[model samples]
Target: MTAPLWGAVPLQADEWRFGLWAPSAADVALRLDGTLHPMTRGPDGAWQVSCPARANLPYMFRVDGTDYPDPASRLQVDGPEGPSLTVDPSQFDWGSHWQGRPFEEAVIFELHIGTFTTEGTFEAATHRLADLAAMGVTVIELMPVSQFSGARGWGYDGVLIRAPQPDYGSPDAMRTFVRTAQELGMAVLLDLVMNHFGPFGNLLPAYVPEMFSDRATPWGAAIDFARPQVQAFFHEAAMGWLHDYRLDGFRFDAVHQIRDGRDQKVMRDLARDLRASAPDRPLHLICEDERNLPSLRENGYDAEWNDDWHNALHVALTGEHQGYYSRFANAPFDHLARAMARGQVDEGQPSPEEPRGAPSAHLPWTAFINSNLTHDQVGNRAHGERLISLVGETPARVIHAALLLMPFVPMLFMGEEEGSTAPFHFFCDPPDDDSCEAVRKGRRAELAGIGYEVDGMLDPCGEAAFDVSRPYPAEDADRAAAWRDLTRRLIDLRMAHIVPLLRSGKIGDGTVSRPTARSFDAAWRFEGGTLRVCLALGTPLGAVEGTPIFTMGDLARDAFALHVEITS
Candidate 1:
């Protein structure tokens, strides 16, 4: 609304000017600490007031007669329903030694702060970055930490796009968490939901009615990215994470819902602007859209999580065909091969359920995040089952071998490396009302879409569901140790040989051949040598007779190729 003075800005040592866009509000007042000062609105419908910027000063916006929280607030100390707090960005002390990490060899670990540790706090997660570094993780992808209504709900339902969730820790704790990760040579990527705001405690519409567009998403009203004001809001929010926290990158959740009905596409513009914001850093931008559109990378985004790979590979290994997986029934290995060699297997064909996607063979191998497990793949199901439980540990490890050794970038869900057996269920703690019922019914319909039943699904609002999802330290210490070692060895092999060969284009077109319906072999010939993997379904695979670089259990064979000089 106002020219370009976004949010609150410091004028002098203690003087700060509070600003907001509430074009629809006739009268506005700024409530700081306890006293309320009437704010003057300009002809353009922007409001402002300058006052003392005290540390941790609590404030709110009183529009007309209704009290509302600042939509641009950096820290929501209390819940989203409570007053906003002043977070002095200058006080956060990140050391001067952060030079940023390149994403060419990125290995991401997707973690939910609320369920990553026993404490579920940023400080608690900070203590574990060293261990992750030892595991050879290059980037730690944090689940959305943005402020949401209740304590937790996978953080996708965040209302405040900039503020960190108070339930996790202080605002400084978020900064410390990123600083610690960078100190360990691992970049921290924050997941953000820019499509729609959460249902409860949303105050933007209360002040500015045009903040939302006529277009609607399944979550709520679609943001009016067509408007210049709305575009500025998101642009500034992305800059906040880049400047305030020095976050290495960002992962946008379900970007398909961001409907920008205009001449200038919002996603492309936002990507261009974010890259301009940090010119010195190799800031990566990732998307989680079902449509593996190549234009997303052409625009400026770094990568996308290839769910096709997960679904195709999951059905192949577990032999479960339901929901979106029914299309991969013909030849599962072919589906896997297309994803490995080509970007996607569907090839612009009309999908079984939705009218989505096109051919992406033109896209490079670096355009997708190849992984066997992720939060959405596991949690969205009727029962939150990780790949390990569905296909058994040995088979899951065989799949993991292909995932980590492949040319594309790879990601791991939290606790997956150690085989913790924890269920990352879709749990929420919304209030008891019609909105809550809508969530239940919506989840039921969503699971039904995927060929799953909701008769025994865990109640999203129940505390027991949230409690059961936490990754307990170790009930089975020895098994955890074995999983950790196996994962470490596989990662070492990828970094030591596979990635180098792929970069130099020495790994030629890979071939996937099935010896029997029970097993398949994927081989790639390199100028130096060859890499072959034999995966047997439901049983231990036969020895390849080359060299065993890494082995899973009593299979007595590794996923690497034969007749090479490599040693493990």
Candidate 2:
């Protein structure tokens, strides 16, 4: 096994130079545009070839006299098994934009294009760009648009890495989606899964068996990043998205499952290469890892979705301690208090479940608090209970306000802003029985630990899950207005004061004090020169108590202490 070529520049541009370590193959040829370009075998057991004028040419690879698709093709027109297309990055007309927002300042909005709107297409989703921009969202993080087996999917099961899903419209539609978002001053973040491919319609194995490693993940053995050829495959895949699609950043899904026993981490190598390749462009790497934060920081990721904050906040607000929320039931307010101020909750203590030493001491984490309406939380549940259903509207609104006010980068799932009454059920459209069975078994096994029955959850093969997850349009004008007002005010507060104070590290000790009788209700108060207080009244009460009186006694003589409720 050869060591990874860290930050190695490609041989040349336009002329595609390809290399793969395949000692087992007797012969190798680079197939492009119905032509075979014979690859020369190097002394290191690595096959190399450079095809002249290969830009914008459709191509594939043949190993040991048998044809196979390029595992790391830049443009896959059909499925992963289909012929590869060499797309010229310069062909697209980027209208008057060359820069993206810094990772720290970005307010990311994660959305599934198929479910975000009534029309499940990129062009239709583009129409909502103004709404996202109006909500102060700086980045629209799309859950993988890559072509899968069928019409509808969550995108994690995508087999075609390069091609945009045809159901979500064509390649032009995706380009328009990005262009529209860019025109609206919002950078586009694409979610990429380098860890593993779905079972359905994947043709990668037909070409290179080494693509799937001997190592195992929860899903299955993923692409072998430690292997020399596998490393090259993934590196090129990462660069391809940046160069071909012009994606601003990538949200690596389930990166913890990317098994590599090599000395150099594949993620670190990818990050290093991406930075070296496009030093000017903003390339944010966000991971969804349940492990300690040190791995993410040391591996050079911009941010990791801080689920610890979410878990703690969920338990605090709803008192639902099932599944993984069990570990955070007795967690002190100081955990959340510190996270609000410092961006991490498990900074010091060892996780109750994981045997890891302890989480990273301090790291900036995107805080997702008190919002249980996310796909993972809702769909994974037995009954698919929405947040409003589990916790009443009053408590839900209070929790939502607290989440927005929290110091870390806040993200709202689709329909979450308006108190979306609709449930986000787990959905997929697998083409075959084998793929469908794999999905059903996988989801069932994952939920079994939480005491949820497989039969209870929506089947990935069924059309019910896909249909149930769709958003319900706002019927009541009052509810719609309330949601709009709440979001606008929260966003304004974040921009005006909370973010600045958090950045400066000036916001000191704060507490969400709640009346003993009404524990679900709470008030957040910041202690400083100018006292800022935000109260959430969950229940209708004649009188509410608790006020912090300073020694200065700045209150006016005639001014009596009164509860102030700001409702639109």
Candidate 3:
């Protein structure tokens, strides 16, 4: 037993120092290399021990005679229930001369790395970085990569916070990924889940009760961010990703679930601490807050996932209102206008999901990331339907144009730009047979009452679910090409005409009245310029006088959209 700080600390090629936060334990021991080494306790109730770290070495902390994986494990072998391994962070050489892209000039592409490429590895996904960069994507927001239990799962169930999923290769794989992405002029932001750990192999409760709180989130447990040591654990997680991984940003998952019963808000404190971690390099701290509050930006988030905007636009375009989609059921177009005019809608209004949400007053459009489709909006549905599938192709394109034309920053879910036929279903690999059965039941029950999809229709734990979730090459060549062409033109139009005016705060108050039953003539004041956006719902729009800056399809057709920079 010896004195050392928390986490796996490498001393030499073979020797390593290990520590664990086990305040509630009466005794602690390091179980590794087929031997039990007694650990010494620190003043702050941490247990420390030193041991050998080899490629074959598997280790665990035995506190009060119960063995558990290290809470702050940097790398894990086998899985979360498996042993923690020592990782050497000094070997990798990160790229140089790159700061993160600001939200003001960002076009985010959110992807599930496991399903982004055929091989589903970080190394394999690196092959497509150039393709994305060429498509005008500025930031690549990766779905979580933490070590969840089993052969395959979406990373939200991860138990090991610092370690990359073994299924996706090692830590160096991620290091190489970040370095290569930075070199390719694309910034990578990792999605991290701190609200709760997965159902299986989560060891914090055994080590100490203070690690978690009595409060619970929709997933399961809520972490005790109010506690000093617990807060430090998460703070280190943020610092490790920025300073160690050399990543551009962190997309904190479901921040609305984090409960801190204290004056020093955990999120603000964590953000300030993260900002201080790497002063030389720029880093963004984004949040996924369902509450749609503007104050979160003040708390340190660069931007938030604007579900309200999506909900409003989705109901308006598709007219399929069910489950969480019902919030915008009453007057969808009005909500859409509110979202465009103020960057948010239904502020302080009571709804099914939340009791009351804070008004998003004076929030810059850039502060809200607008998109027609997101992981939750598409994947969390009962059947995991894509936006294009939910609505007709023409309506989807019109909505896409409307989404990109908004003053807010734009994002695309994986395969959305290419219009791939594959669906991103809510799929996960459960650890055991009973657990798998439980998962299927839970998933069915969740959607059953909502009337999105009836029970026993889709199984989240099935391999078929993952099979359908994988992104493939775009379906039909000519249709794919047309969609691709439309995407390029819309992005070009946005970057050239709309984005500049938006950043300058010239794109002001906008309105959308039902011009016809199947058409909308929407226009936003561009200060000194006039920009008219017509989403005809495949309904014919009349010819414009000046050369229209951008048109998705023939101006005579109503389904396609037409965007004209009114110069008169």
Candidate 4:
């Protein structure tokens, strides 16, 4: 048997060299630019080939005389079944210097490009960069833009890791988006799914067997990260965006689903290597794992999505007690209080819900009060209600403002600034019967226990879902102007004061020293030059005893205006 390193090849300029560990193949040809170039079989059953003539050419492998696509193909013209194209990613001239902002100073805005604008193209989304910059947003957290089956998708189903979706404009258009955002001083954080491939049009299995494990996940069998060559494959994939695409950072999707039993998993080693490769650029690694806090912190990731904070804040403000909200409904204000103060909620004590019990100690966390209104939450719902619909407009606005002012890094979804009434439905395009049926069944199954009929939720693989998720056009200029004003003000406030307070650790233990409430009615008073207070007027319990829980008590006597809202 060949050693694990036998199939390893270094990345070189212009020419692409691939080594395949297919021991049983009689012949393997490297298909480059529509021509088949026969590969040389080396010792240890490794098939090796290099094409110096085929610079910037799209290619795949033909194994055992049968045409098979590259499992790690960077660019594809269409879906997995469509023609693959060679892309020269280095052609784009990047203008911005590779200076990255520290995590503490970053104000992130998470958006799905397809739903961010009506046009749903990279060029179309470019028009909104000024809006993001004006909102004091330093980083734009783009949902996965990789190529997947069909024209429209949430991007989690992506197979071609390097190529952006063709429907969202071309690879050049993607470079334009990144370069434009960079020019506007916004770092791009890409949401990358490394756990499992989508069910439709995944061509990885054609070139490599046992690439996916028998171990199951919510999506499907997890990718085999423990395998020898697989580690190098993922490492290259991670570095490709940084080295080739110039992406600032990555947000790992469902990292908990990556099942690896080895002593040193691929993620840890990749983290070490990534840190080494680009020491100057902030290699921000964020994960969507709910298992435990310490494991993620110790795993070398920079940050993790805080779903607990979302759940707690959603239940507190919206009073929606269905599905997983059951565990978080009775969550005390202390939870939110401590989260803002200490940065983590589940610092100690066994988690009543998780099978793995509780976190041993407090870990730094990013708190999200309104992550529930995201594409996943809204699209997953049977009725697909926006946050404004679930909780009234006033409450939603108050909660949003509160979240923005919190110590942890806050993320806002598209159209959230002015309470966009349209629902962000799950959407896809050019769907077949099986793809459509699977989407329908899967969405329904997800919302089965949410006390709503599942048949109505928009099918992600259907045309209607894509149509429904389109952003409202800028027809109402006045409303759009008002939204810009509000967002700018909030962001300016955060940048001017909130960041400094949090950095100094001035807001200790997040205590509301004034009025307490049973349901929604709440008020708090604070001392010191800068006071932090929380008052909920439209809580379920009823109106608060006193209006405007005065922080900086002398404000009552001054000409300062107090902003009041019912955060029910």
Candidate 5:
């Protein structure tokens, strides 16, 4: 493993070096396994102490009398408030071989580790990977596993950016999870948060306050990425995760909030460095940037979460236009058509909600990862209602089939394919401080502002929120099996038809035409042939001319059909 700028690094069998960066502190000391040792301070406020390599030894840095956990900690044996533990990442055996699959062939399944299984540990989650693989999920995107305060969280509010949450088992267990997925011919993509650190257990502001700019994000203070130290800090974390655990890639959370003023942006640097780190392996870098900047794809991003597609589809299917969904409320079908053909709905279009995005028609369809539902769409709601609850089973099933056959890459939230109706509430367990109350009030206000009735909303900080949010596959075993069967068949069809067209990576900008008010025909030309999809909601679809791949509902009723026409 490459030695990180900070954290516990093992050099030799008998030598373990611990380092901390605290330029603001007058003095810094390393307390290793209950033993206090004075560290040597260098010219750059970098303090280092070389001790005997002791794995699992509890350690913390005492900066000017107060003890603080390592910001780059790999494992917090007793949560974020406690001392960090020393770990040798090379200790885990990866077993045989796994090189990972290409991003084009990806069928992403986004799962939150804490709620994905009853055990909520990496070990437990690893056991269920084969099930997902069998369902034709090629990529498993784990929501952030970074250690936060307390136990339960969406992982966006992670404090220790490098450490794996103690609730999710050891660092080696996470490694084993990745290896297990790879063995099943599946890649693991971690949702990484580098925009801002969580409110609790963060020691950066306590010591190095200059790391943050005066500007603040909705979550917290904006990280000052212009500073060389800050850039290197995030870089080390990204590279460390890539090398230490052999993770295939990362889906950077809310990169639109990553305000980097410098030409050498930290996000771009992260992608470049990670790509260079693993030239042989297909390392996918996806981002959730609301800006819809085409430059992200031009730079190094494999794909951007197509919120336009989801928003338009949601507004059409459910007719709930609150907050961001309001942007697509007017002419929802038109927005859906644009998203289906051009990859983005608000492509340089006038919108009062947000600034217009660049034209994305030139982008390959695979560059847009489209999904009907995601964690944000479900969890951000006051009650966290799944699509099935909002729009009924038939409409949801029709849309789900269309999502799989679309030219864009497809993603499924956990239990989405299984048609699980369990709500994915925005859950977190922070300290019982002002932050807890702030979270409660903030959520209430946000939901109220979005036109949701917030009085009966579930308390995000309560244990009940997390408990009821878990997807229960056993609750309706037969129905879930049917949903799984349908999903597997759709995925199997996608693999045999759509994936082959996408593999060439040479696809033309698609065309869209409204056959009826609620029905639209969209098609994209690839090297092999043209992939066509006609989705009709409460309207009859016109006769389609091609080899039928999949069809749902009757032609004279609400329906969705996908076809492939080979060019002579």
Candidate 6:
């Protein structure tokens, strides 16, 4: 593993090497435990200092005059704005050589670490690994755990790219959680935000203004990816996570917002390097791109989050076509039919927003990850309501069944399987009242634009909001049992039937037909067999001959069914 371009690097048990790229700073000094040591500017304009130190020592860089935490801090043991702590990666003893599961066999479970358990710590989450593995989840996708402001926020506001949030646990505890999951036959993928830094606690712009472009993203200043130093900063951050934590992969957040003008895009370079770094490991890289770009999958990415599938399915199931849902509201069933048959619903098609997407039908079905409920779909609402709450259990169950049974990879948000109605709200703990007010105002405007009742919306910056976001099992025991049973059956069937066919990564494209606006039949053919699914939202369709591994609702009315056949 190569040394990172920034942050404090522990060279020996009693010696530390600190490096910072601050082109704008005329002078730089390291404040390691109250003593100031001047950093010498290298030929490349980077400031470097080597000093006697040990692990857990608090340090900060005095750039020109103002002190700032290490931009590539490994452990912000305090909050994001506090001093950085030196950590030795060799401290954690990974007991076994755990190779990850293949992307084709993935049954991803995306969860937020803070709300995963009442304790909201990595050690607490470790205890639940067996339960997830037993549920047949092949991958556990954690939302960003990067150090952000205050005690909480969806990890997207991460200022320190490499540091694990101290609120969750120490860096070693995080490693333990990952290793435990891997031991239980589940690969762990971390959600990474590389597009822009958070609004607060980011001191990079103050010392290294050249790292950012004149343009800005929705979050903050746009990253100047064209610069070699800027590219190295992000590349090293991601690589450190992959190597140090033994993480299986990453889900790059909001890639559509990442605009790299260079001929060799930074994302592509990062993916290539990550896979090369661990050629023996099954490293999967996924993207959350709105453009529906196929090159990402064609290049080095394994798959992209198919929000098109969720949007179309949500509209068809809930009949609520506000905000982004309006694009599919006109003919959601048809859009869904396209999404299942091909890959993207917006494949070079016009939309209410803009002319979105490129041709995606040529891509393999597994290249798209489909889900009924995700953090974005739930938390972005005026009231974070799960699909079970929106259209009732029967309909939600059917949609979930259809999603899992599809040839595409399936992902479930944290509490969907148990029929938990706990609201996954957009909660955060801002550093101060001014930041709190800013969050409140922005959240209100966002909800109001979505045709929601903004006045009754929960305050995002309040502790009450965070409390409500912690998920719990369903209140009704019977309903919860039924939901769990159905989920287990569906995933079992997927593992047994769908997973084998996907192993070759040569899945035949699905053919879908809509008999009525409320019903559809879809099937995909692999080398050895054909997998079929029939779904009806508000009405019944003709049932297939064979008995389905999973069935929900009345087959004569609104229902979902799955059937499979093998050929010599």
User: Candidates' lDDT values, in order?
Assistant: 0.77, 0.64, 0.76, 0.65, 0.85, 0.85
The C-alpha TM-scores of every prediction are 0.91, 0.82, 0.91, 0.86, 0.96, 0.96
Candidate 1 per-residue C-alpha lDDT over 208-317 given as tens digits, one digit per residue, 9 for 90 to 100: 78789777787777888877777777877887877889888899888877666753388888788788878887888999887667778888898888888888888888
Residue range with the least summed lDDT across 10 consecutive positions in model 3: 1-10
Candidate maximizing lDDT = 5
499-561 in candidate 5: lDDT tens per residue? 888876556678888888888877888887777777786577777666666787765544544
Q: Clashing residue pairs, candidate 5? A: none
Model 2 clash pairs are none
Q: Between the candidate structures 1 and 2, which one is better when assessed by TM-score?
A: 1
Off by over 4 Å in 6: 1-3, 350-353, 505-508, 559-568
Cα-lDDT of candidate 5 = 0.85
| Reference-based TM-score, model 4 | 0.86
| TM-score of candidate 3 relative to the true fold | 0.91
Per-residue error (Å), model 3, residue 165: 0.8
Candidate 6 lDDT, tens digit per residue, 1-568? 2566788877865888999999878999999999999999977778999999988889999998999899989997587777989888987999989977888788999999999998889999999989888888899999999988888788889989899888999899999999999899999999999988988788778888988998867877788887778888888899899989999999999887777775337888888999999999889899999888898898899999999999998898788989889888988888888998897999777666677889887887889999989999999998898888888866776778878877899999998878789999998888789989998999888778878887778889887778788777437888777878878888998888888877645555688887666777777777757777777877777655665656665555445433344333
Q: Every model's Cα RMSD, please?
A: 3.3, 5.8, 3.2, 5.1, 1.9, 1.8
Instruction: Give the backbone clash total of model 5.
Output: 0
Model 1, runs deviating above 4 Å:
1-5, 40-44, 262-264, 350-355, 433-438, 445-450, 505-568
